[model samples]
Target: MTMYSTDTPVNGQDQEVPPFGTAPIPGSRGEEKRAHLQARRTEDRADRREAAEERRRDREHKRRMKTEAKNAKVGLALQKKAERQKLRAKRRKERAGRLVELREKLSHHMPLWGLPVVLVSLAVGASGQADAALAAGMGWASGGVPILTEGMTLTLAGLTAQAIEQRRPHGWLMRATWATATGAAAINAAGHYIAGVEDGADKALYRAVLYAGASMLGLVLWWIVMRSKRAAISGRSAEETTRWKRLARRHPVLVRRARRVVDNTGLSLPEAYAMVWQRANGAAPGEPSIREIRASRRAAFKRTQAEAWDGRTRFSRTAPAPAVVVPAAVEPEPETVPELASEAAPELIPAPYLPVALAVPGLDGQWIAHRVPVHPLPAWRPCQEPGSETATTRFPQGQEPLPDPSPDASEDEDGTQPDEAQEQVREQVADDRLDKARALVEQAALEGRNLRRHPSNRQMARHLGCRPGTAREYLTQVLAERGIRR
Candidate 1:
C-alpha cells in the first residue's frame, strides 16, 4: 500500500502540494482546514497581544495619574508647611519686637541698677532664706531673724533711694525700718538664747554679725533723721506756690478767685474752698463768654487738619495770623540818682558806687580791709576780722554812719554790729553742716565698713568739709546738747 506518495523530494526538500481536480481530496481538504485553523489562531494571538497592550496602556495611565496625584498632594503639603513656617517666623519676630519694646519702656522708669537689685532682692527673700533655713535645720521661728534682717535691709535701701530721689521725707518708711530692725534684733537674741551659749569662733562670729547689724540699724536711723531734717529745712512754701501755679493753669478762674480770697480777705481757708470754687466756675475768669466763637474756631481747625491728613493740602493753619499793632511810645519818667549823705564823708557818692568797707581775716591775727561797692542789701552779713573782737571795726568810733535818721531811731539802735551779725550767720550755717555731718557718719557706720578707724576731730572735719576748729566746736556743742561726756 506504498502508493505514490503525494509528496516528492525536490532539491533535498519534501513538498506537499494539493492535488488539483474538480473534487478535492480528503488529505488536501484536511490540509486546507488546518491552514485556516492556524490563521485563526494567529489572528486570535494578535488580538490578544493588542488587548494586552491596551490593558498595559490603561494601567500605565492609571499609575501616571496616581503618581501625579501623589506629587500634587506632596507639593501641596510642602506649601502648607512652608506657609506655617513663615507664619511662625512672623509671630516670633513680632514677639521679639514686643519684648524689645517692653524692655525699653521698663528701662525708662527704672534706673540701671534698680531692676537688677529688685530681682536679686526678690530671689533672696523668696528662695535664699528658705534654703538657708532648711540647710541649717532651723525652724521658721529660728529663721525669722535672718529673714527680717535681709528683708528690712532691702526695704530700707529702697526707701532711702526713693527719699533721695523725691527729695522728701517718708515717715512710713522710717517707722517700718525701725519696727523691722527691732523685731529682727529681738528674734536674733531669742534664737541665740534658745540655742544655748555657743563657744569658740562660731560664737564670736555670731556676736560680730549681731554687732554689725546693730551698727547698720543705727546708721539707718541717723540717715532717716537727717533726710527728714533736710526736707524740713528746705521748706514747703515753695512747693505750695508751685502747686498753686499748676492749679492756676488748669483752672484759672477758680485759682484766681481763691487767690483773691486768701490774699485779701485775711481768711484761713482749706483746699476744699478751691475745689468748691472750681466746681462753681465753668470757664476762665476773663475769657470770651459766647460759645459761637469757640465752635467756629474748633470747626475750622478740624477741617484744616482733615484736609492736611488727606494729602490735599501741604500745610495746615490752626490759628489765624495775629494783627500787627504799633503801640505808642511812652515817655519814660525822669530817674534821679540819690547821693549817699554822710557827715563822715565829705564827698557825695553815687547810689551805685557807695563803697562799704569789709574787714576780712588775714594771717597772724591781722585784718585785711577791702572796699566793696554796695548794690543791694546782702542776705549774709559782711565778713569780719578773726579773733581781735573790735580790733578791725567796719566803721571808726565817731564816724558811724546813721542809715536814714529820718526813719525810726529805736530800730537803728536795735540793729546788731556787723561782726555779731556775721557770727550769727556762721553759727547757723555751722549748725546745719554739723547736722548733715552727723547724718553722714551714721550712714558710714551703717555700711558695716568703718569709714574712719577713729571718728577724730580731723576725720570729722574732713567728712564735713569744714575747718578742724569748727568741727571740734560743733562736736563739743553736740555733745553738750546731748548731755554726753567729752
Candidate 2:
C-alpha cells in the first residue's frame, strides 16, 4: 500500500507509445499500398476542384466581353440603320412627282413644233385644188377668157376638149362645140340676171350650163376609154398565143393538143375564137364572128384558172415532179388592136410599156408578179429529256428551257472550287445564331407556362436577343411562317 512510483525518467520529452493496433490501424506491406492510393486520390480531388474554379472564372469573363461587344455594335448599327430609314421615307414622298414626270415624257407622240405645221399644209393644198377647178369653170363660161395669163389660160383650156386635141376646132369637134355653146349661153343668162336678186334664175341657169360642159368632156373621154380597153384586150390575146407557143415547146403534155388545134383548123383568129367558145359552153355558134371567139377565149381562160387553181385543188402539184407535156398554145398571129374610144389615151399607148414615160403619176411597176419558190413552214419539235423518253412539260412553269451553260462557266483548268468563302461564313454565322435563339425560345416558352401566356414583351425580347419592335416583327413573321391566321 505504501506508494512506490515504478515509472522511470527518459529523455526530456513526452515519450508515450500507442497501444497495439489502435493508433492508425498500423501499416504493413499491403496496408502501405492502400495508404499510397488513398493519399493520391485526395491530392487529385483538390487539383480537380481548383481547375473547375479557374474554368468558371474564364467563362464569366468571356461572356461579359461578348455582351459588351454586342452592345457596342447595336449602337453603331442602329444609328446607321436610322439614317437609311430616314432617307427612304423622304424619297417616298417625292416618288409620285417623279412617276408623273416619267409618264409624261413617255406619252407625247409628236414634237411640240411639228404637228401644227403638217395640219396647216394639208388644209392649204386641199383649198388650192378646189379654187383652181372653180376658176377654170368660170373662164370656160366667159367665152374662153382671152385676157387670162398664159398659164391660167392653159389650165382653163386643158379643162375643155378644145385644148386637149391640140386646140383644133375639129375632130371630136362636136363635143367641144357643144361645150362652147352651152357655156356661152350660161354667161349670157347670168348677165341678164344682174338687175336684182329676184329669183337668181340666171345664176341657176349658168350653173346648169357649166355642169353641161364638164359632162360633155366626160362623155367623150368615157367613149375613147371604152374603145382603148377593147383594143388592149384584143392585142393581149394575140400576145398570149405567141407566149403559149414558146412555153408549150418546153413541156410535152400541152404540145400535142395545141398542134392538133393549129394544124387541123388553120387556126385563124376567128376560127380560134369559135373553138375557144365551144370549149367554154360545150358548143359553138354556127359561123361565129372574130368578136365572139375573143369573148369566148377570155371566158375559157378564166374558167380554166378557176378549175385549176381554186379550191378544186388542181393548183397544188399532185406529183412530186410536175408532169412534162406538150403545150396547147397556138402560134403567133397578127392581130390588130382596135382604136380607143377616147382619143387622148392613144397618144401615150405606144409608149405604155415604158413605165417611166407612160406611168400614171403614182404608179410603179414593182407590183408585177415574179416567179419564186415558197418553202413551207418547219414542223415543231417538242423538247424531250434524255433517257426519260418523255416530252418535258417545258412550259409548265413560266420558264424557258435552260440553254447549255455558257462556255465561260466551264470548270477551271486547276479544278479549284469557285470561291464562295464569304457566303459560307455568313451561312455558318446564321446557323449558330439560329441555334442559340431556338434554345432561348424553348426556355422562355417553358417559363411562360409556369408564369402567364403574355409575358413582358421586353423580357421575351431579351430572351430573343432582339429589340422590342424587332421582336414584334419577328413574332409576326414567325406566325406567318407557320401559316397561322390571326
Candidate 3:
C-alpha cells in the first residue's frame, strides 16, 4: 500500500487533499462519481443473469415439443402395426376353416374307396394269409385276411393321389388316411363284438360270411358312387363339347347328351365336352351343382366388367348410387289479369264450333257446336306452303331417274333378247370403266393415299361415274387384293 499525502495544493491555495482511495471529503466530486460507477456495475450483472435464464427457458420448451412429436410418431407406427396383424389373423382363421371343411369332405369319400379294398381282401383270404393277419390283430375280417389290411392301405393311397391331383395342401393326404384308419378300426370292433362264437371252425365260418356280406355291401355302394360320378362327367362334357367328330360318327346319343349338358351348364360346347370326357374316364372330380357354377361365373363376369386398366379396383356392387340433381320448383307466374276479375270470370271458354268428320263416301266434313269445350294442344305452327323452301323434297345424293322403256323395242323370237346391240355397248363401257378404275387404284396406292375420307370417296365416284358407296367398295376390294393393309 502507498502512503497517503495530505499536503497536495490546488488552484494556488493551501487546501489539503485526501488520499486517492479514501472516501472523498464530504461535498467533493470524486465521492459522487464512485457511487455512480458502483450502481452501473450492479445493474449490468443483473441484466446478464436475467438474459441467461430466458435462454435456458427457451431451450427447455423446444426440447419438450420435440419429445411430444417423437412420441406421437411412435404411437402411430404401433397402431398401424396392430391393425395389420389383426387383418392377417382374420385371413388365417378363414383359411383354417376352409381347410377343415375340405378335410371333412375327403373323409366322407372313404366308403366309396373301400370297394376295391373289399375285392382285394377276398383274394388274399382265399390265399390263406387271413390267418396270419388275424393272429397279428391287424385285421379282424375273416380271421385276419391279408387283403383286409392291404385294402385299407390301398384306399389310403388312393386318397393320397386324389389330394395331390386336386392340388390340396401337404397335410391333406395324412388327414384323410387318419380318418379312414379310424373308420376301419371302428368297423373291426363292431364285427368282433357282434360275431362272438365258441368253436374255432364255426367262428371262422362266421367271420367268412361276415366279410363276404360287407364286401357285397361295399360293391353296391361303389356302384352308386360310379353312377353319380358318371352323371357328373356326362354333365361336364355336354357343356364343353361343341364338335365331337368321332362321337358324332360312332355315338349320336352322346352328342345329344352333350347338347343337353350345354343347355344346363351354360358353358361353351367345347369346354362341356372336355369336362364330360374327363368325368367318364375318372380323370376329374365330381361336377359342382349347376346353380353354383352359374353363380360363380356371373360373379367372375361382373368382376371383369368392373375392372379397369389401372390397378385400383372399383367395387361396383358396393358403390353408392349417384346423387340426382333435382332442380328447385319454379313458382308459377302471377296471372296478368287482376286477381278479383280472374276469380269472378268462368275458367272454361266454349268453342263456337267443332269440325266433325263424316264417314259417308259422298259427304263433306261439317262443323257443329260441341256439348263441351275442348282445350287445344300447346304447340301450334303455320302450315307450310306447297313448293316452298319449307316444303323442300330431299333425295339420295347419287340417285338418277330410270329411262322409260320404248314401246317400239320388243323381245326377239326366243323372248330372251330385247337389245343385243345395246347390251354389247353396255358391256364394253363396263370393261373400260373397270380398266380406268384399276389404273386409279394403282396410282393412289403408290402415293400411299387413304381412300376412306369423304372427299376421296366423292372424287373417286365422280371420276368413275358411280355412287360413293360403290367407289369405296371397289377401292377396298382393290386394296385387299393387292395385300395392302389399311
Candidate 4:
C-alpha cells in the first residue's frame, strides 16, 4: 500500500501544506510565519503593559508626594499653633506672678515699716517703765509697770482695731485706746525726767522729750494705720469725708436728725440722711401720701358703685315736653288756639350780646381793655296789623313782652336813643378793630411774610384776641381796604 502525504514540489523546493483537519508541520514556513506574528503581538502587548505599569507608578509616586507635602504643611501649622499657645501660657503665668507680687507688696508695706517703729517703742517704753517702778520702790513688780502702760495701750488699740475690722460699735474702745496711749506717754516722760534729774535740768528735759516722743510715735503710727484701714473698709475716702462735711454744714438740722436715725436704726449715714430728708421735705402737713390717695380713690369708686346699685341715676329721667309745630306760611285764629299750661310754657331766652372788655395791645405795647359792643339778632314777632289773623304768643310767669318797634320810642337823658347810641358804639368798635387788623397785616408784610394770602380765622382770632366770627369780619374789612380779592 502506497500512502501519499500533502506535499508538493514548487520551484524545485518541497512545500509542506497542512492537511485540512491537521495542524501545520513543526518546521514549516506557515509555522514560522505564525510564530513571527504571535511573537510580534506578544511584544506589542508587553510594550503596552510596560507603558501602563510606568504610568501607574508615576501616578502613585505623585500621589505619595502630594500626601507627604500636605502632611508637612499640616505639621508645620500644628507646630506654629503649639508655639503660640505655649507663648500665651508663659505670658499669662508671668503676668499672674507679677500681680500676686504687687498685691503682696502693697498689703505688707504698711506692716513692714510699722513693725520696726513698734519694736523701738517697746524697748524704750520698757526701760522707762522699769526705772519708774524701781524709783517707786516696787522691787519684784518693776517688770509689771510696762505691762500696765505700753502693754495696756497696745491691747486696747488692738481691740479697737478688731472692733473696727468687724464693723462693731467701737466708740468706747477708741476712747479707751486714746486714754491709755496718753497715760503711757505721760508715764514714760515722768520716768525719764526722774532718772535724768541728777544729771541736770536740761538733760532731764531732753530725756523726757525723747522718751515721750518714742512712746507716742508708735501709738500715733498705729492710730493712723487703723484709721486708714477703717476708711478703706468703709469706702470712705477723703473726698467722701469732705463732701459729708460740706453737706453737714449746709444742713445742720438735717444732719442732726439723720444722726438720730442712725443711732436708732443702725443704718448707714447715706441711708439715714435720705430717710431724714424724705421725712422733712417729701410731703407738707396737708399733702397726702400715695397710699392715702389710692385709698380715697377707692372709697370714691365704692361710693359711686353703691349709688349706681341703689338706682340713684346721675341724669334726670323725666320725659321731655312735646314739640309745637307751626306752619311756615299758615295763620291761626286766636280763639281756636289751645292755651299752654304754666309748666309747659317755653321760656324765650335771648342770646348773650353784652359788651365785653377785650384786652388788646396798645401803642405802648401794654394790654388795654377796650369795651366792644356785641350786636344781637332781633327777635321775630307776629304781624300786629289790624284785621290780621294771628295767634298771640304766651309769656312765662313774671316775664314782660317785648316792646313795639316804633319811631316814637323813648330816648335817653343824653338826647339820644339807646339803640341808636348802641349802634354807633358798635360801629366805632368795628372801625377800631379793622384798623388794628390792618396794622397787623402791614407789620407782617413788612417782615417779609406773604401778604397775598390772608391769615385764617383761628390765627386771626388768636392774634386779635377775639372770637373767630369777629376776626373773620375784621379780616374781610382789612382785605377790602387793601383792595385784595377773596
CA displacement after TM-score superposition, residue 416 of candidate 2 (Å): 24
Higher TM-score: candidate 1 or 3?
1
Which candidate, 3 or 4, has the higher lDDT?
4
- Write the residue-wise lDDT of candidate 2 on 220-241 in tens digits: 4433543443345445566665
In order, the Cα lDDT scores of the candidates are 0.55, 0.45, 0.53, 0.71
* The best candidate in terms of TM-score: 4
lDDT of 1 by residue, 18-120 (tens): 3445464556786787567766877988999999999999999999999999999999999999999999999999999999998864443344445554454
- Using all chains and alpha carbons, the TM-scores for the candidates as numbered come to 0.27, 0.15, 0.26, 0.35
Worst 10 residues of 2 by lDDT: 357-366
lDDT of 4 by residue, 1-486 (tens): 673332335655544444457776558796687557666877988999999999999999999999999999999999999999999999999999999887665343246656888878878878887888888899999989898787787778777877887878778898998888777777778888999999998999899889988887877887788778888888877877777787788789988878867866799888787676656656322344344444444555555558756443559585455578886986875777677758767767664322444454332224666443332434434575553143433332343444333466787688877556655655666666677788888887788876666566666776766778878888877877778756
Model 2 CA RMSD to the hidden true structure, in angstroms: 47.8
Which stretches in model 4 have alpha-carbon errors above 4 Å? 1-110, 249-257, 277-486
- Which of the two candidates, 1 or 2, achieves a greater lDDT against the reference? 1
